[model samples]
Target: METSSLDQVRAAEFASGGATAYLATASCGLLPRRAVEAVTALAERNATGSRGGAGSFDAVDRARAGFARIAGVDPGRVSTGGSVAVHVALVAASLPAGAEVLAPEGEFSSVVSPFAVRGDLRMRYVPLAGLAEAVRPETALVALSAAQSSDGRVADLDAVRAAAAAHGARTLLDASQSAGWLPLDAGAYDYTVTGAFKFLMCPRGTSFLTVTEEAQETLPVLYAGWLSAEDRWNSTYGPVRRLAADARRYDEPVAFLAYHGAEHALALVAEVGVDALYEHATGLAARFREGLGALGHPAVPGTSAIVAVPGLGAREPELADAGVLVSNRAGNLRAAFHVYNTEADVDRALDVLAR
Candidate 1:
């Protein structure tokens, strides 16, 4: 695909929904043609009953390769799951018992629920601004999202990593909102979790989890399945079963179709280039905010693709009626841009908001 420029991306032959302005990449992204094709091919294989054969289901391997590329880690370090929620639970299960986890209030429930449900652990909710100060001796891990799901505000990852390091605490990041839209250093954190359905423009039921070397050695495997076994195909029914030494051993059994779709989605992201995509989306968001400002519906300042406009919460239906699609968050309207978004879409949205 010729995705070198925004014009090329806007005009590319892809399967973007006919929304005047989608602006909801934060919720769910439109699937690209490559991803669609992958799913279609997988369906064909399944129809012939050929998908269940050995080596026929290479989707998991392909999807892991995609994640490894984005995370700057070896494919062996990558794990897959049906959803980010499942990955979160796996990571939580690996933590040392009785360890304290520091997290922010109002975090995405999936990110909080896994730790909260751990009876052996304690969770301390702290503001993002006070995260560093809240890290204490008992803090074994610190968790937060790379981007705020509500307002699209980005977290200072470097600072957060430093703070966690100072306290000898491992950093666990939820990168679901930022995975395809932003550049991520997965190896920098002790563990990183993300899904492909959002910015990656893949189907649901595909999530990636990356763990560092330290995390691999210290964390215990609470959940085990044949797919994650050291010898996955081994018919060993004994009480003593061996596990894979890499992070892949922690993966859950996910649908092969999800992996097939994710492989193509990640390929599309690679073709577009993450840095270029981020710059283009950010530029579009800035222009979007500017247009709204001229229309007396100013967007909040943000570096992410999401632009939040106050007082538009009640007017969501009104905007939708005029062929605009956005999400309501924290009493604000969140219009999120993506690689598929164009200036024309922004203008269409602006025209509706102006009314």
Candidate 2:
């Protein structure tokens, strides 16, 4: 597509105000105008209880199907959830008692907290650089985010999978940071989880999990809600029933209205094409890095959309006063880029840092 055509399409999709340096994608993405419209339509339906059951069900199914396509998995393998933390709990609870779960140090707190609280499970943290050497036979599950939440470092999924396989470990990938900006093949891992609010441009409180066929039989369902069963509407009986299949087995009750917004966001992404979006986003990051370098504020090595820079140990508030919105962790300023950001935004950020 021509550059002008692509820019026009992106502008149309971006509904936010004047593009004053939006570097907070790691926290939450700027919702597109169409997504806002979809959300509003859903609200209107819910207001009058006019959201037909069949229509809602179909919308939810299509959202799951859209997530499946984006993750390169079968629609039957995708399950809906409210957030990444919920999915992590599902994964942690599914493991056998006393199983060791291996993950990278500095992983998102959501992934770490659940495993940490499990008395029967052992939690192991390996440095991101040393993951290949850390997998062991006793590790029942090896979970890591495809992109580091702290520094936006992209992991080599193929290598991680190979290492996990060598140790007979099943792998779960948190693709929340990479999904809409990178090509994710669900076949590469046993389970993959992602939140729709970031690069997917959906509203908050929306997420999905996909499980490989090999894991469908082995992984346990921790929180089996009414929606998870084979016949969710069947009110017959004594005890609650387990879901019949993989995706359905891990399902939970969620607002189909929220899912409709997510579906619209995914459809917009599909129209733009993931490969094209990836290239655009990466290019923008590269430009931001270059601008930061010129301002003597270069990004940390291995940075991508999420860039981390050195900051005064406790003086990060200074940057905030300068009109540059960024988050700090352990004396590092982390800035994230997305499709909504532009070269001018990078320049503006550089100007703020320079001041």
Candidate 3:
């Protein structure tokens, strides 16, 4: 896309409606204008009882395709989930009983909670540095975030996958923090999960779980609802005899309304180009680091969108007071950059922090 047109797109759609500089896109991103219209249209249709379920289904299908494009995989591999945590848990539950789940210590709770709560499995919290050494014969899976939410450190997925594969274990990656904003070879892992609420620029409650052929072979269908059937609308229910022949067999029904907005959000990402978006975001982050460094508040270096400043917790309220939004992660202020972010946003944040 043309640079001028892209800037106009961001200004007209992303920055309208009193949008803030929202440096917290790593957490909860702003919903784009197209997405807002999608949700509104769907709600209106439903309220009038003219809701074409076909439109909702198309939205879901498009959403699946959108995420698949980002993950560099076919749509057949992607499944819908209400949220990342739910799908992560479902995937965890499918593992062999009494198996071991190796995860990084201080990882996001959603990534670890599902495995930790599994009574039949043992969860080992190891450091990111210890992941390779921790893989053992009993290890059933290695769970990790593609980008560390704490400091935005991009995981060495190739190394992690190789280590897990050496022990005949599957690898599950949470791409929630990195997917829409970063260039990821997501198909490298056995399974991957991401949500649309963050950098995808949609509302909450839309998650995509992509399962590789290896994962589908070993992972059991833990849950199968109407949406998981080959003929979902076939209400001729007898004993639930037929299941989908693909990964959809494990999926459950989600809020179709949310997906209408998610589809539009994903379209926006495609228009902007994922690789270009990552470059744009990281460029802004580099500028942020330089500016903050000059102000004696250098942010820690990392490859992903989030820029973490160590020990800046006390400045949270001050930032909010200045209309500059950021988040506190691991006792530091985290300012995230995305395709919608501008240099002015970074300058505003820096000016506020310098106070």
Candidate 4:
């Protein structure tokens, strides 16, 4: 599909939604109407037992390819799953018993917890700004969110990646908060995981992992099953002695419904392009921040798609009552703008907060 301008995108794909100002996309994005229909149509096919109805696998393949385009990786490097923690666990489990894992302080739990939970792994936390400088020869892995979930602070991925490479340490990037509107190359890291339910704007129950070939060979195949076989259809009833040679070896059994919606959602993202998405979303966030300043509720400083105002978390319910739905996290009122949002939406939210 040819990419559309942000104007065409908002009007065509994101025009209908319930909230007066859906400023909570950082919490969970608004699904495009086509995505909703794709999911619903799959369910209808299942219920009616339509001819050749077992086409759910097609959706999975399409979503995988769509995400590959978004992440700038080959489909073979991509693996499918349902949770960030679960995928991260694979990387964590592969670390040597006493390997050191370096991560940013206040990084999202899924990105850090997997390594932490491994009692033998030494987990060190540093501020996001100092992460690159903190990487050492002893650090076996450097893990982080591409964008901080708490305040929308984007990490310097280039610096971190270079530091990790210099130290011969692998890098794992969690793009759950960044992938949709933040253009990034997943292949740049040793491993990258993203949950589609949030910024990727799909339904719950689908996540993706991309691995470098070296990382794939280093990780174990402890979770292999019928679905992990290179010939899944033929190996469904057997011991599945041979797993897929690529990242698909890490695949969990497919989630039919989630990927059905994801196929459409990821395609829409590709159609809109993340660079355009970044401009459109962050523009609204900047507008919202400017308005918040005028209202004397200066937000956490950043140019990302999410704007969080400290000390205004208590006002979340007040804004919601006034039809401006947003989120409160870590004592900050977080508002995220996406393709659907407009200056009008930003103004409406500011007007509500003005009182």
User: TM-score: which candidate is best?
Assistant: 4
Query: What TM-score does model 4 achieve against the real structure?
Result: 0.96
Candidate 1 lDDT for residue 345: 87
- Lowest lDDT 10-residue stretch of candidate 1: 51-60
Compute the lDDT of residue 137 as modeled in candidate 2: 87
TM-score head-to-head 1 vs 3, winner = 3
TM-score of each: 0.92, 0.92, 0.94, 0.96
How far residue 312's Cα lies from its native spot in candidate 1, in Å, is 2.0
lDDT of 4 by residue, 49-76 (tens): 9974555777898899999999999999
lDDT of 2 by residue, 176-226 (tens): 988888888987888888988988888887899888887877667776766
**Steric clash pairs (candidate 2):** none
Sort by lDDT, best first.
Answer: 4, 3, 1, 2
lDDT of 1 at 334: 88
Off by over 4 Å in 4: 1-4, 15-19, 52-55
Cα RMSD (angstroms) for every candidate in the order listed: 2.3, 2.3, 1.9, 1.9
Total backbone collisions for each predicted model: 0, 0, 0, 0
lDDT of 1 by residue, 81-144 (tens): 8777887887788777798989987788898799889788998998876777888878988999
